[model samples]
Target: MAFTQIEDYGVIGNLETCPLIGNDGSIDWCCFPHIESSSVFAGILDDDGGGHFAIQPSGEFESAQEYVTRTNVLRTTFETDSGTMTLTDFMPVVDGVELGHTTSAIYRKVTCTEGTIELDATFEPRFDYDRVGTTVEQTSEGVIARGNGEQLYLWSPADFESSEGEEEHAEATETLRADETMWFVLQYNDREPIDAADCAALLRETIDYWQDWTHQCLDASGCPFEGPYHDDVIRSGLVLRLLMNPQTHAIAAAPTTSLPEEVGGVRNWDYRYAWIRDVSYTIQALNELGHEREARNGFDWCLTMCHKDDPGEIGHPLYGLHYPPEMVEEELDHFSGYRHSKPVRIGNAAGDQQQLDTYGELITAIYTATDYGEEIFAGEWEVIEEVIDHVSGVWTNKDKGIWEVRSEPKHVVHSKALCWAALDRGIKIAEDNDFDAPIDRWKGERDTIRETVLEEGFDEELGCFTQTFEGETVDAAALRLGSVGLLPFDDDRMQSTIDAVMDHLMTDEGLVMRYEGDDGLPGEEGAFVLCSYWLVECLALSGRVEEAHDVFESATEHLSPIGLFAEEIDPETGEHRGNFPQAFSHIGLINAVLYLNQAEPGETLDPIGRGATEITTDSKS
Candidate 1:
């Protein structure tokens, strides 16, 4: 029913929750209270039953949207025959001080900048995914929406009237001249009513808070290629931060669920839950960009969830919002899928699979944070050792692998390489800190893994590293071997794999496919953006600097106009597919840009526009 293009949206959040604001000026998707909570405004799914909040020009108009410079606050402008107006949307965020604000709120301000303009707004809420009953009432403060034992207060500075009989909907229209401003606040639950007088100040404080935080990000001074890709790097960091749950420190893969990898396909699954592997990658990226606070938070989350009595058993790959894993995959039959991609799933079944690569990811994140000057307590080190021991115990087993294919497990090459990484980092941390551990055992196991993988994962005839042990299908994951420190850039095997990947897995658009073989899923998905970045890294490392730059430019040319990217891209149409504003995609962009910035001895292209020579191995060895 709701047919909104996934790309036609920008996001604003308070680190606790986020709302997807569409180009047409509608809050189409949001989860109230918590990122994983039930949706209050899900018009992105069901147009009629699902709720929405909209502020727009009354007549036919053209609109544009963008996030404010260096901040997550979204500004949407509408131009109509009458005039033009801009709408600013953000959630109040205050740091370094307590503001006695426990309730969540969305603040919206509208300002006219041209001739007289007529603007209309609506407050429509469908609770519990439109399954629960709700009652709306007009009050002196503003309007009240009550449902599921919770209340939402709507306050406005201007004089507006609520509908009498149909209390569920609130509509208002006003004519405004240039420079005129109107304010509205929608506060969740009942605590203290927000005063209309403070609306302007609240918006200002929120803006300042975001700007201040963005400025703190490690930028041009210390970072090599900060100038050319400054905006992309900063925004990517912000998006990653937005995906982080502040209270629990868990980072979501993506906010929305069931946005298919292919239109009308069944690859839809919820990514709101935090995966250990994803969080590790996110932390590594954040730490590299001088956002150490988020990295520390991610490490602490892993400790709390994966340490102590249970310690998550090493092989478990994900954690729910709270403590235990809640990744029971189920379809939400109530709402139509995005673009009719049916069987919309709420939970990810991949959480239970034996993705052995997570141990490597977790250890790498912890070690990376240490490089950022974060201290690991003795208790945390013990947990790290436990994970390494587990990896050593099961390094030779079959796994569902990083792609989380829904078929019989196999000895994925990437999984084995990551197991080597886990042992490698564990040994490094132990040796560097002089902590107690079986160093010799870890060293032996690490070497054993390297030898096995080098022998079995590579195919001399194919001249590339295969997806699985002794297999011939080229996988994009092989491109990561050099980046992850498992192989040298100039190593013959690594170079051959790089050339083979470009030859087999690349689309004409320069995007890279995840693998050549099917993994038991129906329908075709687009080229993975992360895999494309991996190819760029491989190319840069292999002394193919100019080729890498061409590939990098080609891949980035397909980014959404505002620089956002999805999980996958339709190689044919160049359209974004899957969950939008994807964390991994942004991570890939930041890393590739950083790699190109430090690329060595290559043609000196414009510093901001081209490649860097200093390749960071992430201490994978």
Candidate 2:
């Protein structure tokens, strides 16, 4: 059997957890309660050995799929030799609505739309990645999946005959004629697992809950981003939220990591971790679209998980979903990574690195808390001040830049600019709210960073700032100079830097490479999607609307058939690569949309790159 590509999986989830459903109606990956939880279907990891939950026609079939309008509900229809059938997948809301902290459940309804079709319904609920034996029984509660570490009730009204099966595979069959239907519900609860017979009403209620939640998203134009593509964003945002840990503020970079960008590349690693750089852009995009809660939660989660040694000791640039900075990266002993990209890791090693921008991003998020008219919790603000104080002490000494390059560290311009923003916002807080901060020290450091960039980082011959003080080559991340308000969009230096990056690092297709130097890797990879979006922002900021549109249109062409983008795009083949449905890529799409929409003169738009501090928790609203 051929395995589906990573891009082929459709996602559904509540804010707390998600499941990946292949077009063939097989759920290959799902973690209850949170993305980092033990998988119910780790088949995406082991392919043959991993367990799965599948409901598809037994015979050959034609399949077509789409998400429910403006909601994360996914519908896939299969036209089999016998008949046509449809399956709609969604999560049941706790109280028939989503507000504050909420729980989630995956509910799937299968129905026949044509002549009699013999279909199959099979669920092999594997706990802790199929590492334990499980017992099943058709209780009054539904299909109970019990294992050593966990217990869950799988509720179904489908015509299913319960039987014990092997850990790796399970099966059930149903012959349905036209207009026939079945409903399957999988409810996960620790204290009160769902115990019931028929959940048709609950299924309808869940569907209504999702539809109602979609209504809350009012785009800037007073309508949620609509059309075929709008559904994609809504679905993506919905799925990404599942990566959030509801009790905590943590949101994973991806639900699973070490799914290689290129098949057979050992670069595959776990993504169920948080990165400061990734969420910085995520906050802005989610905020612009009116998802304020998600934005605030992302920032709060980051602050709670991060810890520092002494003030001078670098705080981690990233963290695990569940633990603090010291969490050891766990490598699976049994299963190979997706497509046999071996050494599948569980925790993030990036946690211990000294990416200088994390403090800036955290501070910006704090600043955003005030800007959006939300409050950073009292305890969290104290931590924010601690981090800002640490930034104040180390603003000038460069460790790692925002890209987290493995190469030797240098005084990267973007990282330096971020430090300036940290100090700038820190001073802003001190003035606005009468918080006692080392305002003089912060201002001194901020100005020092600016003067250092102007004097040392600028390359006179190239007419732009270099990536790092000692580096001669231009980098694409320098394009953010305009966007970050380190300098104005129309400033000659900003224009030169954009042109320099475009001239040196841009591919023939206009995609941007992250840098010119070796990033501790042996060879080059695909152009980063975020960098390309930054190009569009820089283009728009400089009054190059036509050029910006050309760039934006070209980037959208890279989305997978399901209208999702990975982290990068291959330059030669134009194939999508890196993590599928990457947060950074979707965030890039939203940023580009905003920039493109603002190109018209009478829109009364604010300057996109004008004095625009890094979009943080404070900025989203």
Candidate 3:
């Protein structure tokens, strides 16, 4: 079996975990029960060793995949020589229900639309990342695969036969005429059989749930959901929502992990966990769409994570969905990585690294939420004060920057600017709500940080801000200094930084790389998707709407056929790299659209950063 290209997949989920269904009618990657769990199907990582669940035509056929308009439910159509058939896939989800109570089942409904077609189905289970042995037994309903102390129940009407010399595999073949339908449900732990009526009702409910959620984006007050990029904006918004756990309000960076940033390279990392910086940006984007409830829920979750027993202690850069005790990175050496990128990792080691910029990202998100009328409670205020105080004392310290570089710590300019933003926003929150705080000291520290960055973090010769203090290398992160309100978009230094980044770090495709210099990692990565969107936001706010639009189009031109983005994109071939359906990339697209919607041609717009006096509330008619 050959590995499917990363871009040839669409995702379907129940707000907890998702399965990546390939265009060729295969679920190549899936994590059972939760996004971070060991994979039940990991064919994308190792084609031969990893197990997979596939349903495709018996003979050669042409296939295409798409979403069920505005919903995460996916449909793949196969056109065979004799007939055309459609396979609709979705995970059952109940609106307003907690994750613990929702059904953890995947439903695939196959219908022949024209003539006759023969479908072959394969069910292979590899529990515990294929480390433990799995045994499958025939049952009245279908078959049960048990391994690693867990059981998977497949409820199907078609008769399945055990594969030759393979007890862990089941195969089935069926021929259907026009209008004939078949249903297959893969459930976790449960053994209750479901009829066609139950499957039909679940499908309807799932579709309605997603459509209603998408409607909220349209009905949102002050949302600019309508425009030339309306479809793209809505699609991005839905992708972000799919990564969010509806019950805990915890959002994953992406569903699958270890999808290499560079194919056949060693730049792969797991993105199943939620990052503080990524969630903060997601809140801002959702807030811009007038989804204040989701924004507030996410903010509340972040604050909960920030509560610490030790005074002035800050949380890790990222956390699991339920705030696990530890996320120790582990490699499954048995399975070859996607496209032979070795060392398929499950957990993340970067969670232990110190990323100081998280304080500013958190506080900026709090300030943005409050500006939109989300109340800040006394306890959350206490946590905010603790975070601000910590930043005040350590703003000058060197640590791992936003890129999470593994090299020696340096005075990264982006980190310093964000520290300034934290202080600035803290002072504003205290002043606005009349909350008691050390206003004078915060102001002093904030000013010192700003002056220090402007002086030491800039290169006079290059006329632009450098990646590090007195460093010569330019970084795409510099584009965010203006968006964070550390500098005005029209400031000469910021303009120079943007120009320098474009001249140095941008690809010929107009997509921006995170940085040009080394980051203590082997193998090169593709253009960072979020960085390119940052360039778009910076240009739009600087009154260069046309130029911004051009970059925005270029940045989004390589979206998956179903309108999803990965963590990075190959500038040369336009292929997706890194984790699929990255939340940060979608957030960047949504925010860029929001910024562009408010920008007046040739007129500088107010910075939509921590210092912004008002939130943009231009309603969509």
Candidate 4:
């Protein structure tokens, strides 16, 4: 079988890991045990060697996928000439139950709603990204696949037959009539057989769990849940929720990695780990949606992972869910890449890069949480002080900016502005709570950084801020200066910067590219989806509500039919690129919608935290 289109897949997860199920009823990508663990089924990456599990109608059929209302339970309907069948897929989640107490199982319930339909089920488990050999065994209860010291048990009523060749797999066939149903449960390292009754109960509980969780957005006293883009906001919220690890509170950038930013390019990198910048963005969005508990948990997790005893030692940009400091990049040469995008990678080497923007983003996240009435622990405050002091000492240094370019570090204006934001927020926290050390020094550094950015970062000839100090190139990240409070939204320089980005970095389709400059990598990448949303936010906050709405609608029109977004989009083809269901993209969508909904027709809005809080207050009133 050929590779499925990246947008043709729907995601379902149990907070530990996620599986991408194509509309054709094939689970093409899944990482078991943990989101960062080796793949159990990775046919999406390599159509030939990477294994997959599929259940579909025997003959040609039309299929469509959708989520059960306000829930993550996915329902894919197949319509054939003879009958119609519905496949309900979900990883069962129960309230109040610890993740360790339950078996991490994927439940697929198939129901024949009309006439009769014959279905084919194929189970191929490729442990360890298809590098380790796996053996399939038939059992009385179901089937088992063992490899790389890991075992997967497939429980079903249909009698599955195991193949005897080198590329081993199991196959089964079932025919169901009207009102008939069948169940398939794949568990990790567990042999407990689950019947149809168990599946039915679990399905109901899972639906309730998601629906109840979603309802919190609407039920929260001060959130602006009722808006023109309510459905889009809710779906984006759900996607962001799926990327969060409930056990570890670490929010992954995406589940599957190395999906490529371009079809056959080398821009692929593993995003299964949590980055401080990404997590901070996710927390701010969750806070805006009134999901304070999740926001607090994510913030706390980031602090716990990045905390250091030495004041001078700064944390890495990203870390593993288990809090590993370094993620050594490795390539899997055995399997073919997605669409032959070779050199499929496992870990992210960029984790160790000096991304100075993290200090500002993390401090801004802390300030936002406190604005929502979340108290900062004493130790966390100390860490914040150390971080601010470190930023004060290093704001003049050169480093990789927000995009994590692999080129030599430069004095990125955005990074410097973020460092200024870090100091500004740190001083606010210290003053707001009467917990202080050296406010005068922080203020001095903050003012100096601002003046420096305004002077050296701005290009007089371009009439806007450039990507680097004294550079002449425009970057989409410059659009964030106003939103981060580095400048007022209506400031002449800020407005000119926004126009510079739109004219230089935006595609014909209105999607924004990160930059047109080289990033020390080969091959071109697609227009970044998150950067496009940043444009939407900038436009909205600057009182250009109609323009913002137009850009937002144009960008969201490219969202998958099921409302999921990848990290980037091919502007020419409107196809998704990069990792599937990116948290950054979804977080951008939520914040953009909130900003658009709150912006007045002729007045500039405040920066993110303050502006978002005003909407909550107005909604409550």
- Stretches > 4 Å off in candidate 2: 96-104, 132-148, 152-168, 187-198, 215-236, 298-314, 323-326, 375-383, 460-464, 522-524, 572-574, 600-621
lDDT of 2 by residue, 203-318 (tens): 66656766655425444556435443455466556655555565556666777656665665655656676676666666666676667777777666556543444544334566
Candidate 1, residues 517-539: lDDT per residue as tens digits? Answer: 78899988999999988887777
Q: Let me know the TM-score candidate 2 reaches against the reference structure.
A: 0.86
User: Candidates' TM-scores?
Assistant: 0.92, 0.86, 0.96, 0.96
Candidate 1: 10-residue stretch with minimal lDDT? 604-613
Against the unseen true structure, what C-alpha lDDT does each candidate score?
0.78, 0.69, 0.84, 0.85
lDDT for 164 in candidate 2 is 66
**Candidate 1: where are CA atoms >4 Å away?**
97-103, 157-168, 215-222, 305-308, 602-621
**Over the stretch 1-621, how does candidate 3's per-residue lDDT look in tens digits?**
788888889999887788998998888888888888888899989898798899999999999988898888899999999999999999987766544567889999999999999999999988888988888777888878988988899989888987635436999999999999999999997877699999999999999988877735455354565678778888888888778877667889999989999988888889998887887787777776666677888888767756766423343578787656357988889889999998898888888877778888888878877776778777778877888888899988887889988898889899998888888889999888888899999999988997898779888787788889846888888887888877777677888888998899889999999997788988899999999999998899999889899999999888898898999999899999999989999899998888889888787776553563232221110
* Cα-lDDT of candidate 4: 0.85
Over the stretch 1-621, how does candidate 4's per-residue lDDT look in tens digits?
889899999999887788999999999999888889999999998998799999999999999999999988999999999899999999988886335444589999999999999999999999999989999999998899999999999999988999967899999999999989999999998887578888899999999988888735555355564676788888999988888877778788999889989888889889998877887787778987777788988777756644766533443577787655448999999878999998799999888788788888788877877877778777778877888899999988889888888989999999998898888888888888888669999889988998898889888788788899946879888887887877877788888888988899888999999986777898999999999899998898899999898889889999999999999999999999999899999989998888887888878888567322111211111
Write down the lDDT that model 3 would get. Answer: 0.84
